[model samples]
Target: MKNRTKELLREGKRVLGTWGMLGDPTTIELAGIAGLDFVLVDMEHTARDLPTIEHMARAADVVGLTLMVRVPDNDPKTILRVLETGVQGIVVPQLETGEDAARAVAAMRYPLNGDRGVCSITRASRYGALRPKFAEYVESADRELLLVGLIETAAGVENIDDILAAGVEVAFIGRRDLSGSLGVHGAAEHPMVLEAQERVLKAVAAHGRAWAGLVPYRKPGEEEWITHDVPFAVYRNDISLLLEAYQNGVRMLGRESASAHGQGGQR
Candidate 1:
């Protein structure tokens, strides 16, 4: 399948996406319906398993959304298992060195480009139906698959240059873990955290790579958070979105009902 997210990046367009933490295909489908570029199924901090990821991929396919997954770690076997489910890419978390980045990339592709296990019967190749020529599929998958190296640890920031130079298409500045790592502890807007993020993004831009992170919808300074140089951006996650919407709706209705009763409007 054509990875529309990669195509958008190639066109120098902003690729907005969200996390599918609920492990529900409907969230993946909703992300597409909501005009997102992709759905990053969060296996790193959620209960989303391989089968759930595969179902999300199927839902993404139906809606023409690019499906990517965040693996729990930098393990090749974990990445390989995620790729076999037909995801467009792998977001390997806790990158600390160039070798970590390269190893993650190698696990996403086949020989020459990398050493991914061969299996045409997997959903990634459409179970051998869509990709009739195995060789052609291998080449295309290698070229089209996206590899994002997550920079959360202090060591990752120190080795930013080498990490990006290791062929990471996108360097994600995970400010939550980053802040915690920096002893800021959830203070994403702290000066130290902000500086670290800037350093990482600057490194990515210098290496001719892209930077990624989550941006709140319609928040003040949102525009400042996104830039032409960084094409990969996520807009919150499925669980949070649902929580916000439902909470707002309930609060609004509850306030209105309370006001009506206070005004003695009820029969």
Candidate 2:
């Protein structure tokens, strides 16, 4: 499997993606159809289990979408389970130290780059069909996996340099959680939160690493982040978009119907 997302990043292109937090393969497929470069299947904030994640990964593969997963934690089993499903990479949450980052990366790769368990029977290996070329596959996968480290906690930000050195390809600022860490719950736009985010961005840039985050769709400040050197951005989550679209559609149709009825009464 090829990691198109990593290829885009290597080309110095901004890769746009969306969140597949609804635990539905359909949403992941839709992101692919919409021409998104990737979709992050979230296991951190959702109830999605291994089977559901595997299904989403397969759907993404079928639709030619680059699939990455946000694992719930740095547990070796959790990371292995997600990667074995054939996703292109993983976003490890709440990573606070260099050791944490290193462990996460190790769990993503085989013994060549790291100590990830070897199993050629996985979908990642084309279900053992690629066993003949197993060595080559391991090396390619180790190089191509887009391991992203999330800097959402105070400790993570403080140890940002160490985390960067631990071989993560991207440093994603989780502003919502960072806000909580900064003592302001859910205040992602608060000054402290923005300042903390800037700190993380500066650290990433100084380390010569790429950065990513979720952008507010209707907000006017997206240009600021782009200018600030955030090359990867997730537009929104499937659940949030679905909710907004459904609510807006209902409201608009209701208004139009009411206006039409009033005009008919005038007749």
Candidate 3:
């Protein structure tokens, strides 16, 4: 299957995707069927383990959905292990400086370049089916794999320029965490958040790299002026989207029932 995320990135078009915190293979499959270009298996806030993540990655691959795993920490072990699961990319969070971003890239590479240990029989190498040409696969993995650095904190924003120069293919703006660090938790539309986001975009653009982010909109009317030059966009998470729809449906039904009862009493 073609790497849709890479294709979109190369084409300079915005690739839309969302977070998959559910950690269920079925949920990941459904998300893939929904036509998202990619789905991030969130290990930071989710209870997903290595086995579960591997299952999710397979489901995504079956449906041609690019799987990107957000490792729990910036640790090298976590990064390399997750990559071995055949995920197309890695999203390293809480990146505070250029060195942090560089370390992530190094962890995802092999020796003589980085420290990713050799694994000729893992799922990433087609479980030894492609082992004969392991070197070829390794080279391709280096070119195809995406390294995303998530800039969320005030310090990260301050060091944005350096982070972009660290050879990160994409820099994601973690809006919620960024807002919290700026003392405007959940206020993604605040002037402070807007300014920080603009700074990140400018820095990323200057470095000729792509930027990805999520826009939190509670209602239809809230979708205004969010169009930036972001080449990747994650609209919402699965749980939040499900909860919002359920709430709206329940409220609408309740209101309809109340209106019917009132009409009958009047008659």
Better of 2 and 3 by lDDT: 2
Tens digits of per-residue lDDT, candidate 1, 167-238, equal 888888888899899998978788997788888877776776555554433435565444425678887777
TM for candidate 3 is: 0.89
lDDT of 3 at 83: 86
Task: Rate residue 192 of model 3 by lDDT.
Answer: 93
Q: Per-residue error at 25 for model 3, in Å?
A: 1.3
Scored by lDDT, the top model is: 2
**TM-scores for candidates 1 onward, in order:** 0.89, 0.89, 0.89
What is the descending lDDT order? 2, 3, 1
Q: What is candidate 1's local distance difference test score? A: 0.82
Model 3 lDDT tens row, 1-267: 246788888987788888887878888788878888898889998788999989988998888898999999999989988988889999999999989988988898887668788888888888899877878888888878888888899999999888877777788888889999999998877899889988888888777765655553453477564657577778778887766676578587864433345643211
- The ten-residue window of minimal lDDT in model 1 covers 258-267
Report the Cα lDDT for residue 232, model 2. 82
The per-residue C-alpha lDDT of model 1 at residue 58 equals: 87
| lDDT accuracy of residue 86 in candidate 2 | 87
